[model samples]
Target: MRPTFLPSLIVLAALLLCGCDAPVDHYPPNELYSLVVSTREMVSTQVAADDTTAVVEAWFGTPVQPRWPADQMSGSAAKALVRLDNLERAAGRVYADQDDLHFGLYNEHCVTCHGVSGGGNGPASLLQNPYPRDFRAGVFKWKSTARNARPTRDDLIKILQHGAAGSAMPTFRLIPEQDLEALVDYVIFLSVRGQFERELISGAVQELEYDEARPSDGLSLMSIVGGDEESEALSFARETLDRITDGWARADDAVIQVPPETVADAASIQRGREWFHSPKALCSGCHGQDGDHPLALQTNYDDWTTEFTSRIGITPSDREAVRPFRSAGALRPRIIVPRKLSDGVFRGGDDPQTVYRRLVTGIDGTPMPAVNVSDQPSATGLTSDQIWDIVHYVRSLGESE
Candidate 1:
């Protein structure tokens, strides 16, 4: 039973279609999930009336009056994750105070495309071929970490310094370092907040009894266990918060360590070419032979689209099946075709080390896969040396003929 937000979106759409009101130029209180839903689990929870908003609000506070969850996260933990001052600067609408000093850095520069809560549904979002990156998933594409690992802080800073190639994300290199730091901190804040919401919803689905007291009674997810600081519910909430924050704290340790580049001798390049098309490599499956000659180019969806569509059994190509969703505020599906390797434009940086990392971890949220490697002495998979050959072969493909 998925929660349907169709009615609300329908009303909004009708208002627009009938020209009943002026265009929506500003979005107030860009709370996550206010415009577009975040996860299917969230949808299901809403239907069951098992929503976790009150609990999440209790932990993170409302968009207007944001809280820092100091009881569970403070001092060093808070510092490592995000600075309160920086986050506050980036959190709200663009404005000034008594001295007219600028606040709401995020809203000033990012909200039009990233939405208030970083849901990637900002007013200008759908106009782009690929919508802006949604930070809530806590999964970033151009990162140094291995599969499913949290992105290191440096990984984020680098992205800000150099905008993601082949996308509408422009570089903020000219901005002051402090502003960049604030934006990055705000991104982490939105990501952590989104993940926290999903985790709480998931936990409630698994453990919450239908008869449990609701938030109106002052007993929601966090205080539901016994309504006290020493209660089991509070402990569970604290542990969950700690787990999420600890992962971010440990992001540096999870980066893939790439071996030095294998010299691109003819033989090495030849072996790499063979491995590129090898049955086991599977590179040719989506990216065709020699990197871009598929029998017929097929449409592919990134992880964000997969989250709500194919993952939930809604076929992406079936228009009739998808119209309701779009009308209800889901963005129109955009095909993310496999990159033509021959183009030689690597969005995740073209350097050997970066490419090497991409090969080892694969591109997050795409069809690209990490090469299989044999870690065990007797295990059967591509060894590190073999992967290096493939890397060389890939780099060679980009070289001018």
Candidate 2:
């Protein structure tokens, strides 16, 4: 059965029933983790992280007052990704604008758990097992995009319309379409901003130096990143802002290629069963032979929990080390328990096509891996037809249970 996460729903329902007001003030600026400070092994000083913060604020602005350089990025670069007006409407307090148009849609629907910074650290952040997604990481658990590619706009909208069944994320299908579009815009905006911040953080630890005298150089680096042009020195972060926006603009092309589904007959399922236990696919490694693994055997950390915990000497299972982070706003870390497929409770939709996407792309920020598939009948990886058989087997396991 899917997790109810009733406490969170109760809290949200109570607040809405009591007419709790959402904040309209300045956004809580995103920042570096305190765990990094404790590590002391960081190459960038506190000053550099501060500088990066300023650069991010300059480009994105505060939650109450949102903006981007529309003039700087003419043509389809910036505006094509998301409108500033939509962002303004999506952010800040839950109130109407001067024209009486609705604003703060995100505040009304998202801020309680997503946090003002979209870091998934609001009061209710730690109340769930998998935890609300930290949009800052720019990694989504469900999507049709290729690995490391930004999700298509449709992907975000679908998640909003049909919330994850086993998690705290709820469906907003009853909400107005315009409001839903605004929320989608806000999600993309946060993902873009957060990815840039993370890139600089990585840059600081790897390439940058903490200069006491020249503090403004970080802004200069951002000039190339957010300035429509960037150098190759920073591979991932190189042109990060441009790359992110452009990536979103071109996400339609990034979808994984899916072929015609093979018939799901008994013979196909038997073949799939063989592949399930085989070392090549190895589905039993985590989910178990019956596809009903117990939580005791499943211990995997998500990208957000692993950000600090995956350090050379640290891990989420270490309670003492993460205590400071938890006290400071980071949620209590939990293992990403594998799903009991035999129970027929797929977190992402269980439709054949959706399952095909899951197997092809894998879930982002989790231990699930993409199965290798090729068009040709190659010996190295499973073909599209072969994968469909595996899908049939997976679905049959649920029925047998």
Candidate 3:
């Protein structure tokens, strides 16, 4: 009465034959499996600094332009304008007019801590425990590479997108994707323009040094025998300026695509909440019991900022040195500073994925440690899904706070 073995055998054979041409595996193609773009491919065509203004007007509608004295305009102001123009173009449609974009982007995000002109003059800049950057000099403290030299465009992008783990520069991922790109472009434009201006002034000083020397002029106490000869010194100074200018040109001209927006989900938020409160994770210590609690938790504790700085090997003096150069405003309760998450600083600028990157990787040289929950059987390091959830939670915090 059961089905006959011969019929079943015939059916199985037919099914197998039909499926033979079909793929046995359901996995995606190799390329689709990995979304990372190679660095070399990402490099953009170089645009000339002189052409930037034309490009800006062509791309984005004209708005009020900043007026600088004719003499000042020849130097950094011109460069800043060019760079700003180029950035506006690359950022697509977010920036209406250059000045408006500049004021809006910098004021709400950077000026609160770094000050309007980056002289560390912003209201909150004064209150920061460490102070803000003075953009006039163009020196940066936290850099991507170990050398701590000038930051690359990519470096700046990373900092903007993810924020410095222990610093007040909140991850800017929350900014609309286009807006974030525009912001990144603008920041670099400012730094490059500022550096160029500084270099021009430095060149003038070097010229003065050369003029001061006589036929019998000897090396100063600072320039001993091991130092460069006069000709070499002149060459070196020129070369340094050349390098800075060249960097500006390249950075201004390079085109970069904005990263896509990352949408947050629910499961990740639940997990993130747990991790935030867990002793092993220790995020709750500073962030507070429920992340909204007012009492200063270990994570938020003033001492932790110092400890975080030490862990990253950043000296207090170094923090002070760069404080004035920051164009972004003060690191306050609501403003981001070198340490502390006053306001929703850490949660402010960035998107879900960027937040995930910060949580997973921690920062290169700061107190924020990598959160690795993979080892625990009961918990798992946040998957992409979980990270999105955390993003929702963080965003919710913004509304509630």
Per-model TM against the reference: 0.80, 0.84, 0.38
Q: Clash number for every model?
A: 0, 0, 39
Off by over 4 Å in 3: 1-117, 122-133, 136-190, 193-230, 238-266, 279-281, 294-350, 357-386, 399-401
RMSD (Å) of each candidate, 1 decimal:
8.0, 8.4, 26.1
Candidate number with the higher TM-score (1 or 2): 2
User: What tens-digit string does per-residue lDDT give for candidate 3 at 117-208?
Assistant: 34444566555544555443444544332221344556566667776554455678776665556565555544544444333333323332
Top candidate, metric TM-score: 2
RMSD to the native, candidate 1? 8.0
- Against the true structure, candidate 2 reaches a TM-score of 0.84
Which residue pairs in candidate 2 collide?
Answer: none
Worst 10 residues of 1 by lDDT: 21-30
Which runs in model 2 stand beyond 4 Å of their true positions? 1-24, 32-41, 71-78, 96-101, 204-208, 211-238, 294-299, 375-380
Q: Is candidate 1 or candidate 3 better by TM-score?
A: 1
> 1-401 in candidate 1: lDDT tens per residue?
23568777888889777552222232223232321232444334452133456556666664444556766763465446777788777666567789755677787778779876677887899888668887777888899998988898899989888888877887889877887888888888887777776666555545443123333323246454335665444555667777777778889989998877778798998998887888767778777888866433345788877665777677778888777667645677777877778777677787878987888888888767887777642334677777878878877886855
Looking at candidate 3, the ten consecutive residues that score lowest on lDDT are 30-39
Model 1 bad stretches (over 4 Å): 1-44, 47-51, 62-65, 74-79, 95-102, 210-219, 222-227, 230-232, 294-299, 375-380
Better of 1 and 2 by lDDT: 2
Q: What lDDT does each candidate get?
A: 0.70, 0.73, 0.41
Q: Candidate 2: lDDT of 114?
A: 89
